[model samples]
Target chain A: MSRKFNFCAGPAALPEAVLKQARDEMLDWQGKGLSVMEMSHRSDEFVSIANKAEADLRDLLKIPANYKVLFMQGGASSQFAMVPLNLGGKGGTANYINTGIWGKKAIQEAERYMPVHLAGSSAEVNGLSRVPRQFEIQTSTDAAYLHYTSNETIGGLEFDYLPTSDVPLVCDMSSDILSVPTDINQFGLIYAGAQKNIGPAGLTLVIVRDDLLDQAKAEIPTMFSYKVCAENASMYNTPPTFALYLSGLVFDWLKNDVGGLEKMADINQRKAAKLYAAIDANDFYSNPVALENRSIMNVPFRLADASLDKLFLAKADDAGLLNLAGHRSVGGMRASIYNAVPEAAVDALIEFMNDFAKTRG
Target chain B: MSRKFNFCAGPAALPEAVLKQARDEMLDWQGKGLSVMEMSHRSDEFVSIANKAEADLRDLLKIPANYKVLFMQGGASSQFAMVPLNLGGKGGTANYINTGIWGKKAIQEAERYMPVHLAGSSAEVNGLSRVPRQFEIQTSTDAAYLHYTSNETIGGLEFDYLPTSDVPLVCDMSSDILSVPTDINQFGLIYAGAQKNIGPAGLTLVIVRDDLLDQAKAEIPTMFSYKVCAENASMYNTPPTFALYLSGLVFDWLKNDVGGLEKMADINQRKAAKLYAAIDANDFYSNPVALENRSIMNVPFRLADASLDKLFLAKADDAGLLNLAGHRSVGGMRASIYNAVPEAAVDALIEFMNDFAKTRG
Candidate 1:
C-alpha cells in the first residue's frame, strides 16, 4: 500500500525528495500559475529551469569549460547512431571495445555508417563477466575515436578504471555516469540516457568536447547533429521541457541535499558493498562477474538452483522489492541500486535475500 | 494569484482539470508509489497507459483501422526528414505546398533526401495571409505523397478543408489536432507534436496508415523509421513516458468532461469567432490572415499604429494574457486559443483587445 523499493533497471528509482518536490509544484511551478509543461520552452521561467539543470550538471561532474552540455531527446539508443554519424564520417574507422550488450549495440549501429574495429573484447570470459585489460588488445592508430560502455546494465560488469588508449575516449556511461566521479577532460565525449541517474526517460545528456563538433558528417539529420544542437543551445526545436525541468530538480537535490557527486559516490559504494557482501557470504547465492568488475550500480546474482528464481522474485515483490527479476537476456535477479535507491532499500533487499537463502537453503 | 491565461503557441495551454488530475496523481499514480517518470516504459503499468492513450486517440479521431498510432519523439521537425527518407526514397520527388515557416522548413528538410515540388504557395499574398485554394494548386500524380501543414502557428493560416488530390496526404498537424474532427481515411499519415492540444513537449504522435509501413527506406536511422517504431509498438526505445502519460490524461479529460471532438470543435469555433469579431469591431485593430483561412487555434493581429505594439503586449502581460507578443518574424500580437484555453480566456483577451484599441485610437 505504501512506497516500494523499486529496483526497475530504468526508468529506475528517483529520489523521494525530488518526487515530492515535483508533486508539490506539479500545477504551479515557481508560482508561475501554470505547470512547467505548459510554459513555453523559450519563456524566461522555463529558460531558467533549463539553464540551471545544465549548470548544476556541469558542477556535479566538474565537466570542462570547453565541453557543451546538450539536453537532447530520443535516449541513448539514438546516441548509438548519432555518435557514429557525428564522430565517424563515412568510410572512417572507429574502434569499439566489445565488453557487453551496450557496447555490442553501439558497434552494430556504428558499422551501418562506418567501419568499426574491435579494439578490445572480454567476450572470451564466460557471460562477458570481465573487461579486457589495457595490454590485452591492440588499439587502432587511426581510429576516429575509441568507444566503450562503462557499465553494462544487463551483464552487471563495470570497468573500474578508464581504458588506457591513445585515441579519443568516447564512453557510453548510461548506467554509471553520476554514481561515480571521473576526470571529464579525459573523455572526448560522453552520453547517457536520463532514465538511469539523470532524471527520466526521453531526455539524453550529451557532453562533447569543443573540437569534436566539426567531425560530424554533412548529411546527417539535423536533430541528431551534435554540432547544431551545441550551436543553438539544444533549442533547435521544442525540447522535452518537462523532463528537462525535472532533471534540473534532481541536480538541485543532488547538490543541496546529497552534497555532491563525491558524497553520492560514497553512498553508492556503501550500498553496493552491502548487497554484494550478502551474496558472497553464502554458497547459496552466486554472481558470475569477476570481483573487480562487478557493477556497483547493478548487482546481479542468482540462487544456487535456477528453479528458485521465480519464487525469489515473486516473494521479493510481495515484500515491496519490485522489478527484481533479471533481464530476459540474463535471467536470474538484478537489483539495480541507482543514486535514487537509498542505502536503506539495499539493506532491506540484503536482509530479504539473507532470510530467503536461510529458509530455502 | 490564480492561473494566468497562457497563450504560448506550441507548449501552449492544458485543460485546468487535466492539470489538477496530474497534480493529484503525480506522486502515486494509481497507487504505484512512484511518479510516472520513474516507471519503466516497458512496465505493464506504463504499457497500459501508452496503449490506452493510442486507443483513446483513435476513438476521438475515428482513425481508420489501417492506421498505427505511434508515440514517438523529436517533434515535427524530425518528421520533416523522416517523411522524405521513409516515403520518397533517394532522389524521388515529393509534392510540398509552401504556406509559411513550417512549410518551408518541411520542404528544406525533404529536399535533402528527395526532390520536392512546390504545389502551391500563399507567399505572394502579402505576408502569407492566405492559403492557395484547392483549384490554384496542381497535384503531382507521379509524386510519392503530397505534404502540407494543416495550420501554421506563426502565420495563423489554416486549411479550411482537405486538399483535393489523388496522392496520399501527409499533414503536419503540430499546432491543431484533436481540436476538430478529421476524416482519417483521407490521409496516409499525420503527425503532431504533443505540445499543443495533446499534452507537452518532446513526445510526437504519429498516425500512419498500416499499408505505408513497408515504404520506409532501409538507410534511415532506427529511431526515424516508422516501420521499426510500429513493429516495436512504439517501445522502439524508452519513449517520453511522462509526456505520453500526461497526454493520455488529456484525452481522458476530453472524452469525459468536454464530450468529444465535435463538441470541442464547437467550443473552439465560438472562442475564435469571439476574438475575431473583437478584432474586426473597429478599424483600429486588424487581423492579417484572410478570413476564410484564419486558424481557429492561433490568431495573429496587428495594431493600426505599430508603435503601440510594445505597450500593448506589456499591458496584456500585466493583465495576465501571457505570450501575446507575436512571433518576431510576424511582429504584432498572437493569442493561441488552444483546446485548453477556455472561453473565459478568450473573452478576457477580446475584452482587453477592445479596450486597448479604444484607448490607443
Candidate 2:
C-alpha cells in the first residue's frame, strides 16, 4: 500500500522505517514466539529493549549520568501537574515564562498547586508570534523552578535562547524534542510526549536531574512521584510496553538511519527554510512569526484569501498531503514537519503549496 | 514463524488473530496511508476507530446509559490514587477489603489521601489462598465507599461474591474485567488495566456512574478527574490512540470471534478447571488457593519437591510453554489462562505437567 504525508500537530507522524520494523516484529519480537506487547514488562526480552532505548536516547542527547530517564505514561499534560507537585512542595512560588498556549497550560496547571510568578511572557512582545527573550524573564527570589515550553506546537513559537535562573529550569519540549541537539545538563527537568518526535502517543519521555527526584510533595501520588518512578526504573506499573517498544525502534532509527540529532537538525533547518521561503516569496501566503523566533517543527501560514482555506486543505488531501490543518482554536494551515517527516514530504508540500497559490490565488 | 503458548500474568498472551491484524495494519491502517499510532486522536479516521471500540466495549459489557466509559492512561496503579482523590472529597473513611498484593497497594495509596478502614481481609480467613466472605466484611460506620479487588492477579484469588454496602461500591477489576459478564449497575465505578484481559498495558478502562463524576476533590489534577475526562470524551488530551485502537480490536474479537463473554467464560472455566484438577489429582503438585475462590485467570501451582521447580520451568520453555515461572514475590509456576490463552495451551501444559511428575516425582 502507498503511504501519505501526515502533519498532525501532536499525535503526529512517525518514521516509515520505524513503523516497518515494528510491523515486521509485531507478531514475534526477535523470534521470541510472542509479540512484545504480549510480554511482561519484567521479562528479560522487554528489559533489554527498555535498556537499549534509554541508552540510545542518552547517546543521542549526550545526557548526563546524573540524570534519570523515565519512560512514563499520561503524556506531557500529566507532567504539567507533576512538575509543580514535585518541585513546588517546599512553599516556593513557581516561576514561569508564558510563551504560547502550551506554556500558558503549564502555568495554569502549576497554579492549581502553588503560587506562580510570571517571569516572562510572549504577550509582552507581539502576542503568540514571538517568544519572550532571556533578558525579559524575571524569576522570583523564592522561585521553586523556572518552567517554560521550549516550542509551542499550536502557535508555532519557539525559544531561540534558553532562559537561565537561580532556580531549577524545567521545560515542556513536546513538539521539538528530537529534532535538534539538546544539552541535557542545562535543565533540571525536560519532558516530551512521544507522539511528535519520539515515537507514538501513549509514552512520555522524562529526563530529570537525580537531585530533583526527592523534591516531591508529601501528598504526591506514587505514580506521579519522579523518585518512585525513577527508583523502579519507570516500571512501578505495567508501562505502555508496545508504545515503549515502538519508541525504542524510533530511538534506533534516530541513531542509525537519521545519523543522530545533528544530522536531523540540518535536514530540519533545510526543510523549514525552503517552506518559509516559499511562503514569503508570494503575497498569496504569509506567516506572521518573527524570523529569529519561528519554529522549524510547526510552521503556521494563512492564505491571502480566507475563502480558499477549505479548498486548500481539500486539494492537499487529494494530493495525499494529510493533516495540514492548523489548531482548531486558531483557524488556518499548519505544516508540522517533525523529524520523522522526510524532507521529500516537505518538498512535495512546498510544490503543492506553490501550485495551489498559482491556480487558486 | 511458529507461535508459542505464553502464560505470563501480564502483559500476558494476546489472541494470535489480534496480533496478526495489528501486524498487517501497522503501516497502513485501513488503507489510510499511516499507522493508527501516527494519526491524531482528533482526526476523523482515528475518532471512528475510537468510537467503534467504545461501542463494542459497551455492547460486550452491556454498560448502562448512566455510566461514562473513560479510556485513560497510567494503568490500574494510577487508579489506586484516583479512586480516593476523586471519591473521598467529603472526608469519610474509605472502606477497603484487602485480599492480596494489589489490594494492599491500593489501600496504601488510598491512605495517603484519606482515612482507610479495613472492612475485611483474606488474612482473616487463612492467608491470601482464600477470599474473605461477604458476610465476614464489616464496613465502618463512617464509610464513604467500599473498595474491593474483584480478582487479585498476584495471589490467584478471585472474590466468590460481591459484597453489599450502603455506601457506593468501587471495584478494581484489573485482572478479571472482561473474563465474564456482570451487572454494571451494582457498582459506582469499575477500573481495569488493559494488559490482562482487555488488550495491552498502556490503556486503562474506567466505567464510572455519571452522578459520581462531580464528586472529585478540588485538588484533583485535571487528568485524574472523571468529570473532565467524560466531558472531553477522554480526549482532554491525546488519550493513548494506538492502545485504544488495539483495545477496540480486542473488543471486536470478544464480540465477533468469541461470540461474547458467555462463550469466553465457558472456555476459560474449562481451561482453569482442567489445570486445577491436574494439580489436585497428583500429590507431586499442589495449589493452596480455595476451590471456590480460585482465579480462573491465573493458576499458580507448586511442586511437592521444590528442588524440581527450575528444571520444570526449563523443560516447559524447551517445549514452547513460555513464562511459566510465577511472579518474583511468590516463586512457583503460574499458567495464566486469560481469554486469549487457547484451550489447547492448557492441554499442552497439563500434558507437560503429568510428564514431568511421572519422571521427576
Summarize candidate 1's per-residue lDDT along A302-327 as a digit string, tens digits: 89988988899889988888898888
lDDT of 2 by residue, A289-318 (tens): 888888999999999998999999999999
> TM-score of every model?
0.98, 0.99
Candidate 2, residue A330: lDDT:
91
Candidate 2 Cα misplacement greater than 4 A, ranges: A124-128, B124-128
Question: TM-score of chain A for each candidate?
Answer: 0.97, 0.98
RMSD of each: 1.5, 1.2
DockQ numbers for every candidate? 0.71, 0.86
Which fraction of the native contacts appears in each prediction? 0.68, 0.83
User: Which pairs clash inside model 2?
Assistant: none
Best by DockQ: 2
